[model samples]
Target: MQTQRNRRGYIQHFINCKHLWLNELKKLAHDLKNPYLLKENVPEYPRPEFHVSHLKHDTERGALCWIRTDGGFKDPHRGFRDPHKWSLVWWSLAVGPEEIKAAETRLLEKTYPNQTKEQAVKQQSFLWRFATSPAFSEKSRYGSYRFTFPLQDVLSAYSQQFCFGAPPIMRVFRTCLFKKKVQYSVLVHSPANRELFSEFPLLPGNDPNAVCAYRDGRFIWRSEAMCETHRY
Candidate 1:
């Protein structure tokens, strides 16, 4: 059995990163090498239970908010049925209200090439239904970002070059979040390389303001930070 202090420490660490704690627990289990002992001394914490409650509330509120704004069915199961749906919703939220309107306009023009302005507006509004639908906000069983490249050439170029020797490319969707007073990204990865990509420094250590590269597969998404010339 873990000591009380040890249990508290483990719980605190686990709160920071559940996967890391679980990994450490697995390692400990293997080192002990005794199933009977492992069963008797398993670490217990209330965080996972609390986390579920927090997640459920967030999911419900997010879903309801989307439904009220979009005039769509309020199906909570849709988020559960499709994992990408939640991320997409999160992504949509990340893009400020103005961007969403502009994106809708752009999509309408592209999707309805020959339609008149009035017809296209009607069609586009209908098309926007998918974007604001509960069907697209489903929480995924496997939590990660999903990327769908619209252009085949963009997909092909990245696949051949960047995906080699790297992890499986699951999904890639873009969103803006505030980090250090500027909008930073929170990306999900399939073959998640959290350590490798976490602090991807774009330039040498000397430059405080440098554009960073967030990489997955063959593509590198650049941050908005301006790159500084190297001062040798």
Candidate 2:
């Protein structure tokens, strides 16, 4: 009962914040469209197939490494030659809400201590959805960045934000699927605005210092030019 009540409280926060579709969601939250008390059964742990360790971090990890951004905007859902890549990597499991809260605490105080309080709140909000939602896609598919950060944390706090809307923006953090061992950073529902597709520019863009021309047959970036190249 308390969990159900808490979920309602969380949903209500959206209402107070004037979320665009809160009216439809508020009705659904109250059992107007579905049973408000219904819960979905979830496995205690993910199956072997879902293990993130098996993911390919040893090789390329499917990145256009020369481009400063993660693999390009290759989400096939956007149609051919989209050129816009996602900045987020979210993993999901059916953990209890309490576990989610503990994860939030552990991540903020220990994992991402450098972020400001405001940035930390945004990270926690994204983590909440990552732990509870069952919508994460497999990490290796559709082009994603892996092993881009140290084991302790994901992306930096000062990461940029892109918005299709006028001013409001959501910052995306880089999370790898593997570190010393498997981290299981599954891809969850990214906060994307389709209308922003053509407008919002994704990718860190190509720095002339770090271009990878396919020499002969294989893709390669000249390492000898390291002194010349400042960033990736």
Candidate 3:
């Protein structure tokens, strides 16, 4: 009886923490203050905007990184293709207050992997996910999963260019995914700094062989190879 009661207590505590984390996450996402320059380039569709938060200044123990996105089926266009089968991805960075604190330490370890001189110095994992439940199981229908690291990881590469004076503003990288002879499109999220991305190739506008599209969207890529790696 005592063990059963302890188990019930633990589960309740987990549920409470989850609720608190999610509430804080939503507040951070909707509190947009700056003008998002990249939103104007994309085709206006009702897609969920992804968010990240860091209470690095806070003394609180349960600070977290929250992500809102869709999982499986390759990309966002797949979700649009089958709205009824779309799955929402949501999860806290850590399971409990103790783990939440450890998560920050893990972030440091992830960012600077050369800390331990004994091990092979290399880039640690990026674009990784962790979940409190078995939602990502092979046969499961649930699709909630959260990226384990903060949004800073995504902005780190263009840190010098995009984040020198102010917090980097994320923009969309319009992408064309060609898989199984069917072409689909979705916005690739990135910092809005044009200098870093302007030189790279973009998906052609109207004409696949257009020499240079002047009024066309800024940064684009026909991700044919990328599409082969995942299901459409």
- Candidate with top lDDT is 1
Ranking by TM-score: 2, 1, 3
Q: Point out the worst 10-residue segment of candidate 2 by lDDT.
A: 46-55
Q: Give per-residue CA lDDT, model 3, range 57-152, as digits (tens).
A: 111122122112222112233344332333212222212333323443455566656677544234342212231222112222222222343434
Q: Residue-pair clashes per candidate, as listed?
A: 12, 2, 0
In candidate 1, what are the lDDT values of residues 78-159, reduced to their tens digit? 4444323432223211222333345456545665677797786465333223233221243332233332222334335434
Tens-place lDDT per residue, model 2, 1-232, is 0121121122112111111221234344454323321223322331111111111221243344543374423333333221223443232232234434554565456655687878766752434333322223224332455433321121122122332223322221121111111111211122455344333232222332322222222122211111111221
Per-model TM-score on C-alpha atoms: 0.21, 0.21, 0.19
Question: Candidate 3: misplaced stretches above 4 Å?
Answer: 1-147, 152-162, 178-232
lDDT of 1: 0.31
Error of 1 at 163 (Å): 35
Note the Cα lDDT for every prediction shown. 0.31, 0.28, 0.27
Task: At residue 193, give the lDDT of candidate 1.
Answer: 53
Clashing pairs in 2: 73-84, 73-85
